[model samples]
Target: MLPDADAVSRAAADLIGSAVRAGATTLGVATGSSPLGTYAELGRRVAAGGLSLAGCDAYLLDEYVGLGADHPQAYRCVIRRELVRRTDLGDGHVHGPHGDADDLDAEARRFEEEVRRARIGVQVLGIGSNGHLGFNEPGSPLDSLTRVVELTERTRADNARFFDRPEDVPRRVLTQGLGTILRAERLVLLALGERKADALAAALTGPVNPDCPASVLQCHPDVHVLADPGAARGLLDSPRRR
Candidate 1:
């Protein structure tokens, strides 16, 4: 609940910078307008010679299935344009879940293994309007593994602005499981606007159940959730919604 989105981004960027200063070598990155400001702040710091991501390895939390590597809306390309290309981070140090793989199951296993080996120290995330973490939609199991999932209609429609038409958004994606995300040493979740108010409130104060996947964040020991006034209105207006 900082002043606004810009303030929230500054706080988030400070947290990330602290992690890097503490020798954190692996970073988990997410795609979405919610995190764009934070990435921009980081890039500003790098430009000022106050930070460097050269020593860090970045991991993607999810990727749309069936989108080609060249797709503009692909998580890979989005991250590149928003984060990687803006900072010292290079393509060689970036890793993403292979959503377009021929063997989806095998790809999931490999991605999970790679993430486990890297042992991410800081993970950035953005909450979907429907309480999704990454591409993990409502009803995603708390202990699920890296795997494929169908995009909720609400999520598809929310992302339609990134495509030419509502039908152009990918129907499926490969996302890191709740379990995988919990393994990170730190987690920062960003929520913005009134559109995310209901979901953020449910996730923060409601029961920890699959019906609200992001509710599982309550189980994380080092999770930090940042939301604007509109998004935090529910939490502020009442002690609990459930």
Candidate 2:
């Protein structure tokens, strides 16, 4: 069943709380509007009750290739502005691919190794309008791991909001592939808005296809989808929700 975004955030916070209590050391996180509420609520928890993140390790899902680390819309900057700076997670705990690195391949491999060593306890994801998960666009191999990807025309258009002009958007990205994301013991996906309703229905009720990469989550044992009422408009009529 589709859940409201706030309910999803609360559930994610509860899971994070449980993980902290259980001594989980690593977390996989994603960017975009869908996770904004989750991060906000988590920040509140840190403020109100002292949810310690000092010992936790964090791995971000993706990053644009040419954007500077300080770019306001860069994933690194977004993480810092949203969750990292708001909480007590130390400087070294938050990890993401080096967007400005000279060696992109080496950076990708390093990220993959970090994930291998950390063994993420939970992964938070936000589905793309085109059904991508972490820049793993249509036809990405189900078992693929970390890699550099050329953003599709649709993806570039969707992300143009972060750039001054459509031409300013980067054409390529580095992201954890489907296999890398699925390696997390638990996965939480957040979707919202009417524009996302069709994609949500396709992902939850339609056949699993490379064309709709998010649909693959249906096969995972521990995947939870969180969508607001607008995003769940079609889902409300689905048999599973009823």
Candidate 3:
């Protein structure tokens, strides 16, 4: 039952279109290689005669602490290059954690409030090979909200692809916790490639545990996991999709 990347992107576009039609003003997004295709497709739709993000408000999922907002690999910069700058969404509507904030906790609280007020209509997520969601590594509580977190070695390694050198990746990050992400009315979790198969299967069938933080999605009211055949190998073999 696993879908290819194109299927996932089309499904995401359909969700975005529905939200636009319903007058949704805000969207929560994740930044990573897994989401690149969806963003690209969305950008294409805007480029063609499909949809526009003119009045949309976008909230990013996480930001590495200590990285300058303008840092090329920073989530802000990535979002700008990949999605925001390419869309009609006004510059003022794009929101992400302030990595330079003097009071990190206060900043996290403010972000939580903004999300609450915006009432995000759709949230896009990328799964870590270790099953984390938005930097909420294993053991993160399902009810957690925005907070500062120490990046796990595995996560840092996985994210190193975006940095000039592996060591350049940040050791810490500020992320909207599982609770914050689940607040969105709809959620789309995208995964691709064989590298993600084990984690995806664990999330879909294994017991919900902090070790596999993304497993919390099982409790979400409206969550759709979209994975390519390579990533869905085990799940397809399971009795569920059958």
Candidate 4:
């Protein structure tokens, strides 16, 4: 496990930079407190001429429904402010599902098609205290695809810090499915703090089941998990946690 959040971020950035340098054409970026440092490190790398993401297509893991284009908490806007604006990523090539679409189902289909058309070579993720990945809450099926999902109260509460109040958080989201996330050539997950300990442990060491949506990563061929001391505490008992 990393010594602190900053170390985790640097390690994640190193992997992502390596992927880009090795000819990866598509990258998936995740938004949340856990990944913010990693994005910052990527920005520093680009500024130093050590990395470049301008040639890659970037996809967001999820977006809140009904958030306006200017909504500061909107995942798209957050991504723009945190990663795209901070690095060499092209603004026009960053794509996310149209969460506020008039026809949610159709939009889901379209977004999934877009992601599949240009596969994501690398994906970054963060686990929710409730075991969610990309808004796929605890009960999400292993084979689920990109779709709209009602936000779990627990998940909403955890994300409330991003908004002015708990009620201000959106009630629904469009997120890539477990299957869709697995399609990426490689995956990197960063989980920090004691709050994420249970889910983090379960995702890496527990059974591959729907109860913990992120547990589906166990089926993936390539996945790298980074956790701080607090988050890795539960893994101490599981040899399989590796």
Best by lDDT: 4
lDDT of 3 by residue, 67-185 (tens): 88888888888888889877777767789889879999999999989888889888999898999999999889989999999988988899888888999999988999988988999
* Displacement of the residue 128 alpha carbon in candidate 4, Å: 0.6
Candidate 4 vs. true structure, TM-score: 0.97
True-structure lDDT of candidate 2:
0.84
Looking at model 2, which ten-residue stretch has the lowest summed lDDT?
Answer: 233-242
Ranking by lDDT: 4, 1, 3, 2
Alpha carbon lDDT of each predicted model: 0.90, 0.84, 0.86, 0.91
Off by over 4 Å in 1: none
Candidate 4 lDDT, tens digit per residue, 1-242? 99999999999999998998899989998998999999999999999999998898899999999986568988889989999899989889889987778999998999999998889999999999989999999889899899999999998889899899999999999999999999999999999999989898899888898999989999999999999999999887566743
Off by over 4 Å in 2: 1-4, 238-242
- Backbone clash pairs for candidate 2 read none
Regarding lDDT, does 1 or 2 come out ahead? 1
Q: In model 3, what lDDT does residue 89 have? A: 72
Q: What is the C-alpha RMSD of each candidate to the true structure, in Å?
A: 1.1, 2.3, 1.9, 1.3
Candidate 3 to truth, TM:
0.95
Candidate 1 per-residue lDDT, tens place, 1-242, comes to 87799988999999999999999999999998899999999999999999999999999999999987668998888888888888999878889987789998898999999999999999999999889998888888999879989998999999999899899999999999999998999999998898988888899989999888999889999988888888888778657745
- Which portions of model 3 show Cα errors greater than 4 Å? 239-242
Better of 1 and 3 by lDDT: 1
